[model samples]
Target: MEQNLPVACVDLFCGAGGLTHGLLKKGIQVKAGVDVDPACRFAYEANNGGAVFLDRDVESLTAEDLASYFPRGSYSLLAGCAPCQPFSTYAKGKDTTQDAKWKLLRSFGDLVRKVQPDLVTMENVPQLPKHAIFNEFLEAFDGYHTWFEVVECKDYGIPQRRRRLVFLASKLGAISLIPPTHEKHISVADVIRDLPEIKAGETYPNDPLHASASLTEINLKRIRQSNPGGSWQDWDEDLIAECHRRDSGKSFRSVYGRMRWEDVAPTMTTLCYGFGNGRFGHPEQDRAISLREAALFQTFPKTYQFIPKNERANFTVIGRLIGNAVPVRLGEVIAMSIADHLKMVNKAEKKAN
Candidate 1:
């Protein structure tokens, strides 16, 4: 019945269309995606069922700009995951209150008040609930019922140990995320075991995005000694970096480590393409996981295209895009939650009438 109703959505800060793609898969009609990065335009528009990509900053987006994307009498859903770097656990001890990125949530709240959409959703780091801005964002939903919680992506069948804060608000009575879909957690091998192998720095001719970053001799040696789920401690004393030898650096154990085949992957970050960035190295191969592997770990489809055919793949650019995206599976969970909420609301209305 949600399909019979024109349930249109406008995705804000829609990087590479991850959320839009997932919503589309779950039967939501995404009319447009607004993001400041022009680099995301091609992937966003190309993969998201021809949804228009608006290259505009969320700070500059007005109610009029977003409302135009939804059809008259349609159920309008506004969704976004504001850039999370400022609030990430990695940003510990840094002063982010003064950061301009801090105010983007305020802008999102402002638009919600102006547009008064039928539904709203947001995804962010688990730490966001601790900030004042999060409370400010909630003020935008005075008349709407809201539910938010930190969710484990692995419980939702995502093959990564990513924990994110998911928020839902609706003018339609009550709302919450749907129940977890997986009892047995998905594992690393379960997702990427079938992809053909490529050595470090080697690109599979058939898929440029499957390329891995080249490792220096010492780093390669370190990776070779690294055991699955083991850290730098497994390396020879001679192979240990000077920083890791010191007392302060010993606490940073996950760097230059390998993921276990049977367990979920560690959280993917912007620098996850590098062997030394967290436990990103392959369990059996003597190299970091390729870009394609990282994307698959993020629950992106195997055929998900990141760059145009003419353009050479830049690991940093594509890595950031993939790392920062709302995992496609998590996005589907969010969309399903909304679908269930709509169904309940529709049933109630019918019974009352």
Candidate 2:
């Protein structure tokens, strides 16, 4: 490969272009984003710098299909974050290996073997390292120098306490992630405090995504009684659910809780917009965090488009995209790691020549 050639990337399973956006912010040219969900196309293409959004399953793609996305003779990077529901802690140890989503990782490995991109990266739930399938995925990097670590998103400057496995492999030489960027931590207040506050079920006139899900009257009472950094236990006894009265429910106290302004937030999930789901209640507002708040916690730009114009914002659809996305800040850090690795490789080659 020649020096000064562009490094073009193709992101598989690119949900809402979080990773691609981060890479673009760090000066990497992502040529395309491929995912099975057609809903992702609008946001992926609209926010990214002309990166084509291919609405196709990863399993159905051929090496030729992906290779065509890169410019001729340019360095190729294949990046993806396969659907992690099966490997997620939320799966609760059920034999999910038979789940179709489980095979997506293997499909990712298959493409690596066929396309043999000069660089590769993947991000997933941290528990994946314990699975046998992860070992199988690592086999695809036999000739490449590989590095992976379970990183705390808060340490990477993400305002949420998300932990993920970050993997990097390079045919050029050894590679690793850059050190954590934030030491004091980014508080929940740091990210969303300035946004205009709206009541439950109200949408900010300026942004449709800023809408919050409506709460039942009882739930509204529960949220009003709730304290930041406190669980449902802080609520009046009348507001307690039947499940919480049981011994089994004592351990599930994180739900129906308010976020503490001084601390990072819990991991944003597909249902994060609902106050009943997790620690999703706004610190000061009398409602659950809005969909826009969730996206901001994921480090997406305030102007990042989620629902297209003239389209209604469905909480379920948009929440899933925001929650599942790789935090944009983490993506920038990954891009920086790759940039540093390539610079080292180029200098070594120059000296050898």
Candidate 3:
């Protein structure tokens, strides 16, 4: 735990390198990131200058494969934010335990036991801690000090009202997330208001990612009539979809709503760029939030290179990456906590000696 000692990290399930980018920013040397998605390679490598991206699934990854990346004797940290779709609230009442992703945490635990790194951390949906698989993951750290909490992303400067369960463990000593950075939550206007506007279905010529999805004629009118922070209930009776008129659909009031300019956006889901998903409609525009805007809400920098220069933005691919990624600011808070913990351990050791 010496102050000058080297600290290295390997990020598993590192989609688009959001966590890796944050760690690198806080001076943690991330040697590599591993993920099953080959599409993430370009973005990961492009954004994180010194990190290598391994396109492999965690199920097939072994400790030996990770060891090959870091030099011997360096203080190792293993970080994994395994896919949380199966454990998300969206999957409520569904039999998700049998899904292939439900076993990923087990694979992560196995790798942790095998590698036995100095530190470990993970972030996932709040629902994860309620699952049996989560308890099993904790059991893997029987001999280590662990700390975890369901944290509000807005408290960490992310311009979205996303709540995620974060866990940190160390063989070295106790560690926890950094205290909230912002007393006031950042709002949608704070993050995306400055970007140049584009009409529905039109891609911004200068930035392909800023392109908005095309809206149907009816959907366009619906959005035009949609009030910021108001649900479909505020729309004209004619604008209400037929399904919403049914008794079962009365509760689905969150759809076709516009985000409040002064309030943090609702959680960005895989379909966040779609006008009908959640309250993703733009506060002032007659369109849904664009791909670039969604990335911004996730705390990715405007300059974060997600797609290649010549490649046009693909909504399905980019939306998944942006929505599924850990907010960059949240990752930085975790990294800062780890760095502070190391510094504290170093100080204590020096005094003891």
Question: lDDT ranking from best to worst?
Answer: 2, 1, 3
lDDT tens digits, residues 52-81, model 2?
999988889999997678778777899989
Instruction: Indicate which candidate wins on lDDT.
Output: 2
For residues 104-190, what per-residue lDDT tens digits would candidate 3 score against the true structure?
888899889888999999998888877667777888897899999999889889988888999999998878888999999899999
lDDT of the candidates, in the order given: 0.88, 0.90, 0.88
**What digit string (tens of lDDT, one per residue) describes model 1 on residues 55-105?**
998888778887778789789999999875554443555555566667777
Rate residue 10 of model 3 by lDDT: 97
What lDDT, from 0 to 1, does candidate 1 have? 0.88
Q: Which stretches of candidate 1 lie over 4 Å from their true place?
A: 1-4, 88-99
TM-score per prediction, in order, is 0.96, 0.96, 0.95
